[model samples]
Target: MADDRHQTPASGPAPNTPDVVELPDVTRRDLVARLMKIGAVSLAMALAGGGAVTTLTTAIAAESTKSERKYRYGMVIDTRRCVGCEACVVACKQENKTPPGVYYTVVLENGFGERPDDRPLFLTKPCFHCEHPPCVPVCPVGATFKRKQDGIVVVDYDRCIGCRYCLVACPYQARYSDFGENYPAIEHDTPWADVPSPEYKQFRQRAEGKSPIGNARKCTFCLHLQDENGRYDQAAGRWPACAKTCTGKAIHFGDLNDPDSEVSRLLRERQAIRLKEELGTEPNVYYLV
Candidate 1:
């Protein structure tokens, strides 16, 4: 029996010259497959990151625009039309239910004194709500401050410690210490005693030794009358009691920023003057002398 078998080839490629080896043929399909394996996920992640950045930028821009729409809410009192009636004062008391020594507004009877003209001059004075408020920084506690949304100086009865520093710091005499004195009706425990004051929208009932009693009190420009957007509706009577009840039509309240508003028109038409502008307080309250 003969054994027929294939013999092994022992000779290999030359070591001196590099052997040329054939590789698999590559095509566009191969490139596409490779891209799908790695580049696809990278592209998707990039698109998602770009979308998130766009959304975040849009939201921040909207918030910045809203914050810039700050309102310098203030008053323009036409002194020429004021008749010294003090209706505004009485109306303020009725609205805020201010106690003794806690007058939110007052009329300067001889503010202008005897002028050359025969007409008597009476200036209605309220919390000026100065741009650089003196009372805010003077507060030992953070009891009083001005709102950035609306330039209305506010006193936090909860935070006040009866220090009265804010009262002294106010150059406009806008602040006062509430000593908890009440009217005869409250002292007698009559039906009016239960009446609640709608200050800062707190609606707190009058009581002795309470928060506001020991706190610094001042005019808030009747801020409680404003809407959520800090707007006052004159037609609907949702306005400051003083301005609403002014028989002389002297008090004009509106956003000073709005050129279309009546207060803006008045300020443009007339020469307005503020009390103690030299003090650098920059009072929002203006008087048409």
Candidate 2:
């Protein structure tokens, strides 16, 4: 008998030949949704065949009934109250123990005009944690994500490949790439070098070739201070270091979703503005100009 594997019938083309099929153009969001659906179906079949029907059903039910948003954590800064003292900047450095040139928050000064008589506007800027964060989708490794519980955008340093895609995607220039630069205290092997940063509830000591050393970093709203319920207690001193330490009490942080919350109330009464609103990033951080 002749081997059939290599044999081709008298036809227009080979049997195993693939035909080019033109697919419809899909937007990124549609592509992602389709991929998620494919994954979910695959997982469901695997679990069902493995006699884990209950688990699969429960998971599907939970996903189907997932809430749109539990909280919208944000900040409202009163520019009038800001003294440009940079106390918030200092507090953030001390709290996060960030390396030199890797500040999660910064104070920017803008003059009203080129004239000397123009008054300078002080802006304390941090990660906006946008409702539709461009940074999250651009990260190829899925290292950065917006938390479903509180809407805080965070980075998973372990998964980050340091591609810096998020940095470029961010309109606010909020994300920073860690180049492993250390402060003088850590560089000189001083006693302060032993202190670890309690970032993301991970007390990581600064060292060469570490996860955060090469990962993209950003502000997390001091989420590490939140309790297991994902709630910050200002009375317990569990608030964000920058907001807590603002010398002029310029920064207001709270759950914007709650209408009664301080941030929401401020938004209702004060004339607030967000940066680059035309981009439609929907930044959580608002400035009371």
Candidate 3:
């Protein structure tokens, strides 16, 4: 029985092994702080990216507004003063080198008489150049578009797909499709002119076969003349060839948006009327009765 107390402790397991050590509350707090910092960084990046996108969107909107609201050129024809002289019509043909039966402009006959009570009146009709142009939408391709600055409707011949949808849509019948007819009779007289111009591009020498024949064309308010240096100078305050060449000075072209312009003022002072007002085309072309 010697030292039996020391040898009797051998048991199945120890009683005080100390439960698994618990993490400190401070460690949990530090972990949460790190997570918050990462979340804040991510949120800041998202906000910055959103701000950049909003800035770009605002800039694009401003540019679009500027382009759409810049300018709108128009005409005011004095029907009372027109003398039915085809000078403007002939000038347009000769200058632009249009073929027979393809007139950019025409003098419309209203009545037949020589005296005031029985005098024949004339109305020269050209492209009305409507503000909300119908021709632009109907075009199969975007060949025709109104200038964002001046509101002048123009045709991009090269881009036109010869769909002819614009021609049918126009109420004024202003559009003309080229037929590729050449002057086989006139010796040395090409159906197309050789003048290489941005505004008055004569599609002559047109690849021996290719011509604007398949494209839609119309009056551009004589933009070709306006492009030439000093053309407006020679015309004496005129902006279009038709208006410049009119001996009676019946046609007037100017910025309708400018109330101070001569055409604008005339339109205001006179009983101005547009062709086919029932259709509501808002034709820029005005007539003074």
Candidate 4:
């Protein structure tokens, strides 16, 4: 039985068997580091509304769409800034030489004066250039079309049959039938009539049985001012006449494809509304209400 003390009994704990290993106490620094990691993850999700991976994916998709499409030029009108000066309307006529009763744009005034505090609001209305323009399909001659290059709706005067289908189809009432009637000066064949209109950049002098006289007319966004590639030089004064002449700077025009443009930025930042949205025309024009 010598050295029996060194050998433990089989039922008792062995010399190598140690007490249960205990975990180290969590330090304050460790707790803080864990919280910071969680917070970073949460912030990324909150910013992206998804996760970091989704954020990167969305940005790439947006870039791809922009590179493929030219632009859907549109307008963002700030009603609060409009002064009902009708400067825009006048400028449109001067630019396009539209005859009487063929208004490309108009100012509609609404009064909310049930009480003394109630005020009147002025809205500048132009062709909305709907994603699905109602005026497009009804054209019997395929004269009216929303340009594939830009979203601006255009009428091929040469093909137009002088029918007023577009005027009835437009939800915004943006189209007008030009009855070949003119102001006294033009009706009388005065020198003013000799000055060729800049519409379509055709510079065609006024004459009976002309294109605009019989065909339906609407705002071109002054497309004539655009270059061959449909790019307008704002600094060179070759932009929409209504926007360039706005007395209150209420009208903002730009390509929707460019996220950096002023109209796009305003739409992102402000509460904007489109007319007759229930119809699902998806009008490009927006009103800052």
- Can you give the TM-score per candidate against the true fold? 0.76, 0.75, 0.67, 0.75
Task: Give residue 272's error in model 1 in angstroms.
Answer: 1.0
Best by lDDT: 2
Which digits, one per residue and each the tens of the lDDT, describe model 1 over residues 71-185? 7778999988999999999999989999887889999976867657767888999899876688877766566777667767788687678888888888888888888898898
Question: What is the per-residue lDDT of model 3 for residues 35-137, given as tens digits with 9 covering 90 to 100?
Answer: 3443333333444444343333333333233234445567888877899988989977766666556678888777323447767788788899886578876
Clashing pairs in 4: none
- Displacement of the residue 175 alpha carbon in candidate 3, Å: 1.1
Error of 1 at 142 (Å): 0.9
Listed per candidate, the RMSD to the true structure in angstroms reads 26.9, 15.2, 28.0, 24.4
lDDT of 4 by residue, 1-289 (tens): 0111233343444222212323245554443343344333333444445334434333333233334558779999998898889999999998888888889999988721132456668889989888768887777656777665676778768667777888899988999888888889887778887899887777878778767678888998998898977798889998899999998999999998777999989998999988888986878889887
Off by over 4 Å in 2: 1-67, 111-117
Give me the displacement of residue 76 in model 1, in angstroms.
0.6
Clashing pairs in 2: none
Candidates arranged by lDDT, highest first:
2, 4, 1, 3
lDDT of 1 at 261: 83
Worst 10 residues of 3 by lDDT: 1-10
Q: Model 2: which ten-residue window has the lowest total lDDT?
A: 1-10
Stretches of model 3 off by over 4 angstroms after superposition = 1-68, 111-116, 183-193, 197-207, 227-238
Error of 1 at 259 (Å): 1.0
